[model samples]
Target chain A: MSTPIYNRVALIGLGLIAGSMAWAMKRGGVAGEIVGYARSEETRDTVRKLGFCDRVEDSAAAACEGADLVVLAVPVGAMGGVAQEIAPVLADGCTVTDVGSVKRDVIDHVAPHLPDNVHFVPAHPLAGTEHSGPNAGFAELFDNKWTIIVPVPGADRDAVARLTSFWQALGANTDEMDPEHHDLVLAVTSHTPHLIAYTMVGVADDLGRVTDSEVIKYSAAGFRDFTRIAASDPTMWRDVFLTNKDATLEILGRFTEELFALQRAIRTGDGDHLFDYFTRTRAIRRGIIEAGQDTDAPDFGRAQKK
Target chain B: MSTPIYNRVALIGLGLIAGSMAWAMKRGGVAGEIVGYARSEETRDTVRKLGFCDRVEDSAAAACEGADLVVLAVPVGAMGGVAQEIAPVLADGCTVTDVGSVKRDVIDHVAPHLPDNVHFVPAHPLAGTEHSGPNAGFAELFDNKWTIIVPVPGADRDAVARLTSFWQALGANTDEMDPEHHDLVLAVTSHTPHLIAYTMVGVADDLGRVTDSEVIKYSAAGFRDFTRIAASDPTMWRDVFLTNKDATLEILGRFTEELFALQRAIRTGDGDHLFDYFTRTRAIRRGIIEAGQDTDAPDFGRAQKK
Candidate 1:
């Protein structure tokens, strides 16, 4: 086993990301001691039973004490509160990082609360499943996935490098981007698509003529994929939209404009327009497969699973 | 093997659906002989080499000449011409069916040209993958899926019953619906969702600031799912939008209305509204899982594939 990167590591929230990180850290032997804390007593009990972490702490501040690495894995809206609660107890020269989906707002809320001696690095891992909470995590969740690190300006270079090594050791490829760009890219790639999916599923649910049973039975056609995406954690998504408001709104605007154009083509019976648009989109799917972001297997390989 | 359901079965288009049906029929020994034809000579040549069919004919009429069952497996737009071409050659008392996505349009296009002596019972198997063409077919494609059979007024009851049994033998559950209701149901569960996915992917492709490479790289963050749906056959989707225009347009209107509300909530920083809507959509996903329409495995069991 490799030597530990951090003498001690603290995970502030015991959700899917934190649980997965703990397991991955254990798998790689990358942390000397992993201490976890969650807001709820039930989650703490569950994590303690899971035994992925070295110890479970009852308080966030207690978890951060003497830890050279502290990860804030809470929802975006709750990051600042947790940061404030643990700020005074953090060890000197420690590194504080986050796994929130939105980076700009996280920086705005978390940077001031961290002590000057500690380095604050914000990151978003572009990997997840529809499932959430402690039981949803696995050691291989981040394998071959992209984790974008958004380092703040005037940050200590050594702290950033060490944190990058930590993520790379957890089986994720690492890249750096400015917080604004990171937020904008995530809005396009994650937030907006999720919102659209939620909206479509809601529309299907609200339609009285097409009963829920029929919609559920026929969802394999295409709607089931949307439903999977729409089933993500509601509290997390609420914070995402509220925190990354401008970028998500911007992408949504572009999406609606394009949708209106396609709708008009359908109304006018312009088959060429529809065909060309669809043909162009196929190239993107090919690019995704070529880039190793997803599998080219039919139906995302779900058909083969049967 | 059990007795054949039909003495001879003719497939007019050698695409994914027909190829799969041929394989399923062979697997179940449901037909004594399977004859196939495609508009393109190259497809017919591929089918002959693949040997899924007993024979590959040069013309649709030639394939259907003495067949007891004829499946119009072409695109929705092409069904009318194929029906017209084979009108004179269809054997008396034979059953004709289709695997089109849109039923009302198929019935409108195909029924008028069919011979009165033959029964035209339109059907749609709600199963497919992003991949297309003859080589993409497998016998398991239709296993446990649903096929809705729509019979015209005064259609032969025996013919409908036989067709239903044929689909059941191919490993599908059978249901009957009026043409109009089937169109509306599919619009909610398939067509509108596909259009939205196509539109989202097109929007991402058109963004100048977000490079195609970046979009492709970060697509695992939910955008990849839309890309999969968008990668479906261009001609098939184009025909679907054109033929199911009324029902599709109606659903699209509802989708846009619901989307605007969510957009406004995001703009106004209404977290409760977003949270509630997201929570409500989750129930539909649960229903889909319980109804056996989709897998409950995380990420559609894609992680396990790796």
Candidate 2:
């Protein structure tokens, strides 16, 4: 009913999040034309075949032409290069944003390459899956999820408000945060947890104490929980660790301190200590479930399997 | 078919695993009569309400009377006490077995108290739920799972074979192991991982950094995976850590060593290290899924939501 927010919207990398955004944009009728580009020729061809974009461009600069909004959806490590490549062609009045998990580095990397006319709004949709690539995107992925925006202070208020409304139309709850706090909170909530999962699964795989057969066959108990997270896109996680180094390292340090105390309790045959720790952790889980982020199912799939 | 394997089977505790065993026994017609007992009056009443047994007795000695297979399914911390309580009343030629997680301690606790005419076979059924108590039990919980038995040397071969058949009828694949090795293997595969999960959740809760609301809202990402695991029964986990102290501490030490190395990588902005670790873990998840223990979906959910 209302005018489309952007005349042309460009996606620099048509991976899972980018492709999903394309679908969401089309379903919402939010953009006049959606343009996409990917690093690989095969990926570009695949996005074209999937029809996730109105036009598939081979270069970031090509995609940026005539775009009033450009979203850099590549791994964070690639954001700087993409911004540099697209800055020259970016249309006047266009807004540049990113879907990177880490915020401070993304802002640092992209803001310098952008023209004064382009408003750089760094955002994280706080939604994903273990699956990657163009074909994995879905329209509802961002529905009811949080999208945090980190806009430079005193920057274009109208652009910020427009992006907020756009994410709302995509079914996301939007909030503004300073880039540092965003990175710190996400470190505790996402990055540290992901790294722990990857480490534990790696330890098991390297030990060879339990054959892969045993780990898999008996995984339903608790190990399977880690595997899902460990299966996330490796490249994205690598960039995240590289960029959010301080906060992630600080959380990991805190986590290890707690773990060491637990190990000491176990070593000393301290039943009450173990009991107290286990009991405390249960309350947190109950709170999480009560808050509706999780199901009350005893194990992840037990109810369904039973 | 042939006379039921046991004329009367006694279950010392009727939690998830024990209740499932009773239902599985009845479903497969493996026992002529199943007698169950619980420590507390409330649990006994709940067991009676659930109709998981042919008869409920208030005391272990009374329940084991004339029982041909007396099963101790109490917490690992209570195995010795329960075994001692029932040894005098257990029928001659009865096969006394346990369904505890740790085998060496179970053997040490239960084997010495048993009469010569009665056989003590320490068994660990690698199946369960985060839920405990009689109401949480279901018939098929053990279906297609594993049950590992650690029989003492010179134990009755016939008794061992009969116990093997019983678990097989309950829909588990049974394997024999040296109790010490079994404890050590499980220490790495199950106990240590559970402790780590609990510790991580506890750390997050204590920091209060993620905020309870944010945790549950964004929990569908990776934190919810830890929540399911951390939700496991406190008493059972407490007993596991106390009883399997040496193996558990050993594995915990190894895990911490690896974890610290990872922390250092994060602190140093080592993207390559993080990427390599994450990539290797993903391969392990693939192996587990191929082995039929896990599904590709996160938390093994039926549908991949978002």
Candidate 3:
């Protein structure tokens, strides 16, 4: 085990990412004193019981006192509130970061509230599952995942490097991008895809044409993949779209246009056109698999009823 | 090993499902011989070299001549044509079944063409991977997966029973459903979801505003899951959309309406509505996992670096 990376670390949420961060820090010995603070007493109690932190506090300010690192792990919409509450009590030279999906809004919302001596660096750990809450966290969840760090102009170098080291200790490969670029990239890669999944699942449910039982029974066909995606925590996703509206809508527009073309190909029976369109996308999957981003399993292999 | 279920079994398509079927059959000794046929010489050559079949024939008709079980393993679009070409040569009293995804259209197209003496059963082994071609198959692909059989009216009961038993021998649990219901169920469970996935991926591809690398590299965010579904065989999926039009279109319409509501909630910053909508969907995922349908791993754990 290595020495803790920070003298004191503050986690401002008790959900999946926050809990997982605490677990990773403890497992890696990447921080000296692990402190967790949630807005709820129940969550504080759970964090204490779950042993996610050496100390659990009900207020963000309480957790931030004397802390060298603070991670705001709440929904995107709550980052502003969290940053404000902790700014007053933040230890001198402390660095602030977040695990929000979209980066621009988080930077804009949280940066203004931080004290001059403290640094605010926006980050998105391209990780997590549909499951949420402290119990949903596991120490290994961050292993080999991408961690995008979006540094605002004039952000302190020492602050950035410290945060980078913290994530590196969690077994993440780190990349840096402009906060706006991060949002746009995620809008296409994460936000729109999830929205489309949610929309399609909702559509299937509302159709009322196929009995719900049939959908559930035959989910292995393909719909189950979307459900897996659609099953993601709604609050996190809802916050994503809300904060990254411009980018989300932009991707949505492009998606609708392409969908129309494919729809035309299907309607007109243009087999070659449809085939080529489908064929091009395969390279990306191959790349992902090669990059070790996904398993090559057919969508729902294990659950397939024999 | 179990006694061979058939003296010879001929698989007509050497794609992932068919290749897997051959591997499973050969490994289990469910058939003394597994012959394969493909229109493309390249595919036939690959199948032969892969050693999944005893012989790879150039023509579907030539492949089924002595084969006791003729499995039509082609795309749904080619099922009718393949059936027409092979029907005359299939051994009299031979049990004929298909591993097509859509049942009603397949039943409508293939049943009439098959000779009266040939027992026709429309069966779909709900097993597959996004990967296609002979090399992509594995012997264990169908293990624990459901195989749905939609037999024609007054079809040979013994033949249907035997076919179901054959699928069972290959490690699939078999059930029978009405063809129309099968189509409807698949539309909700598979077809519509695939369409949406294709649409979303296409949309990301068309983003003149966002670079392709951004979409692909950052895909760990959630977009990669849709791409996996989108990267499926275009010819197969196009035919799926065409054959399952009504159900798919109906589901698409419902999906669009729900999307509109979601858009409204995002525009209005109705966090409550977004939270509720997002939260309600969570139950379905829990139900699926509880029913042993999906892994609790987040989005199949796609976000992990690999």
Instruction: Name the TM-score of candidate 1.
Output: 0.99
Expressed as tens digits, the lDDT of each residue in B1-306 for candidate 3 is 878989999888888888888888988889988888988899988877889899888888888998889998889999999999998898988988888888888888988898888888889887677877778888887776689999888988899888988999888878899988888778777887787777777666766767776676677777777878877888888788778777666666666678778878777877788777776666666666666555676556544424
All DockQ scores: 0.87, 0.59, 0.56
Per-residue lDDT tens digits for candidate 1, residues B45-148, read 99999999999999998999899999999999999999999999899999999999999989998999987899999999999999899999989888888999
Clash pairs, candidate 2, are none
Off by over 4 Å in 3: A297-306, B299-306
TM-score per candidate: 0.99, 0.94, 0.94
RMSD in Å for candidate 1, one decimal? 0.8
> Every prediction's TM-score for the first chain?
0.99, 0.95, 0.97
Between which residue pairs do clashes occur in model 1? none
For model 1, how does the per-residue alpha-carbon lDDT over A159-205 read when each residue is reduced to its tens digit? 99999999999999999999998888888889999999999999999
Model 3 reproduces a share of the real contacts of 0.61
lDDT values for all models:
0.93, 0.83, 0.80
The list of candidate 1 runs beyond 4 A from truth reads none
Tens digits of per-residue lDDT for model 2 on B1-306? 545888899999988888999998988889999999998999999888889799999899999999989999989889999988887887888888999988888788888888888888889888877788898877777777778988899978888999999999988888888888788778766887798888778877877556766665666556767877888889999998888888888777778778888878777777788778888888767876786565565335422442
Show the lowest summed lDDT stretch of 10 residues, model 2 chain A: A297-306
Q: Would candidate 2 be rated incorrect, acceptable, medium or high by CAPRI criteria?
A: medium
